[model samples]
Target chain A: MLIERKWKKWVFFYLPMAVFIVFTLFPFYWMAITAFRPDNELYATWRQPNAAPLWTLHPTLEHFVGLMKTTAFPTWLWNTMAIALVATGISLVCGMFAGYALARLKFRGSEFLGTAIFITYLVPQTLLFIPLADIVRDLQLGNTPWALMLTYPTFLIPFCTWLLMGYFKTIPKELEECARIDGATRFGAMVRIIFPVAIPGILSAGIFAFTLSWNEFIYALIFMSSADQKTVPVGVVSELIRGDIFFWGQLMMGALLGSVPVAIVYSFFVEYYVTGLTGSVKG
Target chain B: MAIVTIRDLNKKYENGFHAVKDVNLEIRDKEFMVLVGPSGCGKTTTLRMVAGLEEITSGEIRIGERVVNDLPPMDRDIAMVFQNYALYPHKTVFDNMAFGLQMRKYPKDEVLKRVRDAADILGIEALLERKPRQLSGGQRQRVAVGRAIVRHPQVFLFDEPLSNLDAKLRVQMRVELKRLHERLETTAIYVTHDQVEAMTLGTRVVVMKDGYVQQVGEPLVLYGQPANKFVAGFIGSPAMNFVDVSISGDGRHAETEGLRLNVPDRIRAHGGKRLTLGVRPEALRIANGSDEHGFATKVDVVEPLGNEILLNFRAGGAPMVARVDPGVRLKAHESVRFAVDPERLHFFDATSEAAL
Candidate 1:
């Protein structure tokens, strides 16, 4: 029976898990190899006898160095970092307050309001950018970081609110009631007890919001007009591709470098992020 | 240290569910008042209204001299211990205990002193530095109690505070809570669904059902003379056996399908009327030869509970249990004669269920 169970587990769990890992990680592997492969190896066709498409015989940092020096990669990186951080901060504050009110407060049509916020989240970003672009023009925020900074929260806030609201609901109402009876006002209880207890949820929300804004394509592409003003995603795609010719080597290097910050963030807070989504406050 | 007076308290929820209906209670100073009943009995609702956690639809609640009807919980100068302990998960035990005082802006020295004192009293001084999740259920319960007591508030509200503990821990905590009440002398309103907790810990117990107060008195008084059938059935373990019967024409006997017993003179005025007879399990005993009034029934089940053996049988078309000495040897389907204790018998009106 035990051996049979082990065989079943191998078929059901480990086999699928290995397939999923390879499928997801394959793109990153291709990107890394292309970024390091010497120019001759990168451009060589599979028909060539000397060509090694699967593994590179020679590796070099020429593409990374060339991309960094020839383009405004550092400026784009800084812009992405600053915008993602600021947008995440704004969305998190709004999300925390909105989530708390929706989850905890008793009011007329509060349920309707919560559903309405979620419905807004369901609205596709593809359809939203048109009206958002018009608003950006009216506000004179076009071609500026403010365009993306303010627009990112339009999607980010709803997501964070929905997520944090679920997290807040898992917390027992007794905690706040006890705090209130312990001489803390409603606001005080929220700030002192509810917010502190929700740190894991908050961090997870921040990480998600940061990633969303960092990799955001449509609004950043449309809003940012200058080479230096653009975020990493738009800057690399627009500047590296020079019409009908894909700069695979430099583009791959940009993709690899662009993802390092997000990777580092996930690694540092992976434990908290997992618990935030899956674990409720249990006494 | 406070007298809590709740007058004509009524709570109607938004969806038109009337949760608490006209609850009037005057908890005496330093009294340990327990509100107990089955679920949805309005016991916890009444307690929350007193704590200012629930809004009063219509009524007035006064803590000491102040009318606290419109006051928020923080302004009521009361502390509450929740059923789940509700200890802050991130804070140390010391910080949890000191929170109330810190909120009230007490000096740092005073907060430390009070926290230490409360931790000492709870015998949890060593756990002061640990978070709530690090402690056991009993230890977390102590910390919750410590949090409430450290405030030295005018009143303490407990919402089934020990319900989460295991059976053994519950009993120990019950004794500790009673002792703490005596020592602190703070008026407390505790809500629970457990009758045993109410009976053992309450200076006075209030029994509620279906959003109304059924009876309020000393535990033994409520047990001995329940205002109605509900209280009689609710207050005792194994519950009071209720059997329907009618008084005989002579005003001498009560008769039913399986029982014919002499009616006590005190309730003979209602002769010839249909009524319900209530008998405590302990009040029925295996009859001796000298006993003139008795009933014979076949034991359906025998539960030997160490100190006492419970014999389950059918009488008057209703199932009944007799609490007899453990030495009584009886088996299922065996014939037994039980004498009902006439003095302890209770009669209630068939329709209203009120004691006669």
Candidate 2:
């Protein structure tokens, strides 16, 4: 009876985890399989079991090789990297100072300002595309990375500032008070004391900003009229379709490559990313 | 060394709640002054005001003759140890101790020397390389003290610094703090709600209640001659017992429900009025059958410590506790005769609760 009960409990615990793994990971599995499949095998119908590739068929890197040479994939990758890095950098510098102020300092209308920033974040990027396109034209930033750089922080800063405010608040007020009493000025205390302790929160905010800027499509599509200036998201989608005949293999490859930098960034700061993102959810 | 003076210090919160009301205190140089009271008693508010953490509502604070009302905390040239230790979690112990000196832009070698010297004094030299999270609670406390010691500030403000430690470590740290204060010869203003900590560590204790200073004196003086019922009840461990009694004569003698006692000449002038009798637990003794001064009571509980026994009993329909030798074998429901030491007895005006 005890053995049966123990087995039942173990099964209950593992069931949801197993379901989640299969449900979420199946697409990536199919992508990997298609990425490695030869062009002839990729077209094989799965409806007839025997028509699909069997053990006898050899795998090929033809899609990956074709993906590299046939498109402006490298330039799109570089553009994505540059815009994401610069946007994340700008967001981080602005977010840290703004976050620290919101968390610690007493200033006039701070609550109103914080709420205003958060509300601004709730406004969808898609809704601002037309207005932002005109603004980009007015600023002469059209068909340039500057348009994307200028647009990304609009979404990033408010959320990032709110994220870091929650993180900074968790740090004991006494730690900063101790610094102040020890003859360190407010700025000195923040730099020497509070910032070091809040590194995980800052890292998560940086990753969030980077990922948002990298994956952004609406502004990039609307603002970048030239193909040379297109980011990976817009570039990949536009290039995949020519007169309604879709290139699935190359399109999937572009999608896969586009996600790699964010995945790598997530992996490097996965612990901090989880903590930092969850920290913002409460605020 | 510095004489710290606070004149009519007041802190009225934004919502118009007055936390500290016209508090005035003069702490002598090298004196370990302890500000003690229950929570929300304005003791901590006063300490923070002194440390420049809280802005003074309307008052002057002078540290060694320099009016510090308008100065920011960094400009006050004082060191503080927080109740939570407040060690920078990301920094090594050595860096934590050297932080103040570095902030003052002291040269690297001088900062290192002072940090090392403080670490040696606190016996934390071996743990200097470890982060705050790596150290034990007691070690962290010592590091907090070391952080202050390295500064060598004119005054040190400690806000319940040892309140976070375990009982044994708190007792140990209390002794270490006393010795440190003696060696440093700095004006130290410590705050705690623990009367034992206040009594043991304070050269002079300032007792506060409801944003008002009740009394300030040596520990024994406050214990023996409390200014009011609050101080009498607040100072002792079992707390001094209070019972309503009516004075019949010119305040020479008083009578209650099941007890009668002769009031001392000091209280004679306030006779023919209602009063409250205050007696410390240690002042009450098991009376011999022949003793003239005695009261009989039924024991409700008996708690035995290794060195002493605390007897909880009821006298005149009022709860009372008596501290006795551990060998005394009194049991619950047993009737016992006890005597209150006349010299240790305290009397307060019934209505005002102020000492008569």
Candidate 3:
């Protein structure tokens, strides 16, 4: 009787977990099946009796081949990688220093500056596109990747700095005081002690900055008007559609390919990324 | 070894709050001095001023022969072990101990040698490769001491380094620190709110209260000859008991509720009609018969502490405790006679609270 009751309790606990697994996993399973399905099989109607089985059909690599050939997918991937890497690099440097200053240093306007930086992060990027576009034009950066580089960091820096400021503050002040008394100048202490201790925070902020720049659509769409200058999002949306009739197979194929780099990045540093995102949420 | 002198040290916060006021002290070479008080008594502030960690509002601090009020902490050549242990969390114990030496640009062999020597002395040699998080609380504390030991600074500063440990470990570390001090022969200044730690570890203990130095002497000197009421109350466990009393008959005797006491001629020479009488818990004994200095009181509470029994009772409407022989069977709600040891009694001026 006791064993039976324990079995009943186990079932009760696992039912929701089983239901959630099916709910979230079904779509990804479907996407994988669709990605491998032949164009004929996908277009075939399922209304008729004795219809051909979707599972029994042979998979084709035609969409993948067509995606690579017809669109500027390779160039777009290269452009995205370059812009994201550079933007993430710039954001990390700015954010770490600003975060340390906000966390440890006492100055006249420190609190006000920290608040202002966080407020800037809350301001919508869409609101700044026009002003940023004008600045890009004034700087004669139209039809150039420099426009995206300049625009991406504006969104990334404030949020990264705010996120890291919270992480830096969690470190005990005594740790830094110990370093200062050990004959380190303030900057030396921060660089040697604080930065190493906050590596997980730094990586998390870097991933956010990278992915934000990688998947960014609006600024890339509005800023870079030329074909060679377009990032992955803008390039894919532009090249995959010619007016209304959609290139569903190739468009899906391009998206599948476009997502691989980020997926690989996520897979490699998934632990740090998850910790970083959760840490940012708490902040 | 170097002597540290702090002259007329004053520390005032921005809002006109004085945390330490006109403090003065001189620590000789190889002397182990403990600054002890209750919380917010400016003991830690005084130590920080000596270490150059806190700025002095006015006055001067000299280490050896050089004036150091304007110098930074790094230039002061003083190593501090914080209450929290403050070992670099990301670094291994070896790195934490070697940090100060590396910062001073000591040769690699010399840094390694000093770190190893400190680790050996602290009995943490095997834990050197571990991070601070991996070690126990005691081990982390030893690492913090090791960090300071490697510096071999002119003066060592410890701010309640044993307060984080359990009672047993605190006592154990107190003994170890004293032994280490003797072995190193370095001038050391320690701050603790625990009177036991201060009494056990310091060659000379400075008792402080309300931002002023109450007394400075050897542990027993402060215990036997407290300079003021605050010192009398602060320097002993269970604290000294006080009673309001008035003197008459040309100051030959003093009277309070429930009893009358003969005054010592030495105390009468100070010439005060009203005073506070201080008697340590051990100074009061169960009187065998009626004595001139004996008083009758009701035993309200009895706490047996193995070695001694703390008897809490009411005398003249004020609560008091007496440490008595444990074999003496005493119960609550019963009456007993207690005699104050005339020579051990301390007299303090009612207005100034100064010792008479």
Candidate 4:
């Protein structure tokens, strides 16, 4: 409001907005162009007379077809989907219960327990993986989908629990009290009233858990050394490049396609997701 | 219907702070008992303890001869309407009304019938399909009422349920709630900070302050005969006028600076003792000529409320408001004379604050 001039508005508002949009969108644009460019054009030096790194003169689905036909990319996609979904489901259930307990129940050490759960989320994945890899071998779960499926929850559960804990606190305690007065037991009231009212919070927690598990790298890479069990991130890096050579097109293509499921999940729950982040409940 | 009897009830928090002192009350069957207090008076704590939402520090609560000190809220068979209307966001009004029955394992048809019946009572049959968010604030309050009534519980509890509503809607809903209680004939304990709401809605009103019960009686009884100075002042709008006065001439009259008032015979026993005189705003009137009891004052301000006018004045060094006929015209800061009817005058011991 203070900046009344058109040029001043551009200097203060539109220019900064454009810079942020371009900064965020450039990576996706690069990924898209690289995914469609022919291999010869992708590999050509920028100095070559006909070479263009920013835009391709010709775009083709060759890399996508090659990714499907020549590599285990299809297998990788399936592994990522299955692992992400199960991990998200496991974490969401555990998060909802643990979160409700931490937020609503009155017991000794509940506050300490909540802080401990949040502390676990702050633990770096790199340090955690060292100890986790030992446990993974002790359980004899290495090189299987179960290795990552079970391990992803260690991090994802803490994240989901902390998120859901805050969300549950935003829900009024009166709802549960009213439910109890309405002849529902404590557990009954939680399930019937609290959980229903917390749908936005639950959906947002699920989306975050799904995205985190889908983009997971170190666990997928270390746990599954076998070709068929590898997820998209590991499968692309391991299988696409030969020694002293890079498969830039297929690498970009994998990253591009790998993000679609997470994108779709976000778009579907965008409304609930916003409120979940903002924690605004009407009535 | 059930009688809720609470004996020697007390509530002390985990931090060693006592919020409710020993309180004993018997809510008779079908009685609408209101606990009215200012903030921090523990009225809500008492109601919550009755609802089994708060643990009683030490007491016995009997609902129809069953000591429910350790019973859970669900087993207590009471329905509470919360201030925020606590409607499940994901459920339609129909589902919200039906949830309690479903949890109790009621038959499907019976659940539907109860929901429809309650909806009909609240005039929300058309809103059965809508979620709570789809309704306005007043409609949502009605839905909350519908949810509470659908179960036909033995007792009803209300915790400032109308405080969130607008003025007109609150008044309308207050009447509706009274009518609902009559039709249901269930014992209820209501807690509200608004004295007006308590006076209008309670069959018997319990006025509390600082975690202590100040007075309990019918509205007019509490109004006409307040037990203490606090009760006398707190129960009325614009507040009662209080001035320190000393007995004059055999204690038949009390005298303040430039004003003299006849004391009641009960208070005249302490002939030379200083006391506080209490007068309700409406009890003061414009003095006519030759009135012996008239006190002189300067009108400080005038508030012309359409039906009547209030004269704000200073008499005997205490600010006071007087409800006068709208036809009476007086300018602010103008000197005026006023008198109090002797019967309406209240006298209290200055140290004890107990009414005489």
The prediction achieving the highest TM-score against the true structure is 1
lDDT of 4 by residue, B204-293 (tens): 999988778888899999999999999999888878999999988597888989889876787768899899999999999998986689
Interface RMSD score of each model? 0.8, 4.4, 4.1, 1.2
Q: In model 3, state the lDDT of residue B11.
A: 97
User: Candidate 3 — what's its lDDT?
Assistant: 0.86
Residue-wise C-alpha lDDT for candidate 1, range A1-283, written one tens digit per residue = 9999999999999999999999999999999999998888888899999888888788899999989999999999999999999999999999999999999999999999999999999999999999999999999999999999999999999999999999999999999999998888899999999999999999999999999999999999998899989999999999999999988889999999999999999999998899899857875
Global lDDT of each candidate: 0.93, 0.88, 0.86, 0.91
Candidate 1 wrongly placed segments (more than 4 Å): A1-12, A47-50
What is the per-residue lDDT of model 2 for residues B1-356, given as tens digits with 9 covering 90 to 100? 59999999899998888999889999999999999999999999999999989889998999997999989898888899998899998889998898888888999999989998998899988998998888899999999999998988999999999988999999999999999888999999999999999999999999999899999999999998899999999998999988888887767677888898766778777778888889889999899866787888899999998799999998866898999988899889999899876777888988889987
The collision pairs in model 1 are none
The candidate with the higher lDDT, 1 or 4, is 1
Question: Candidate 4: global Cα-lDDT?
Answer: 0.91
**Following a full C-alpha superposition, what root-mean-square deviation does model 4 have from the true structure?**
2.0
Q: Which ten residues in a row have the lowest lDDT in candidate 4 chain A?
A: A1-10
Ranking by DockQ: 1, 4, 2, 3
The reply for model 3, stretches above 4 Å from the true place, is: A1-13, A21-27, A48-57, A273-283, B269-272
Best by lDDT: 1
Residue pairs with colliding backbones in model 2 are: none
Candidate 3: which docking quality band? acceptable
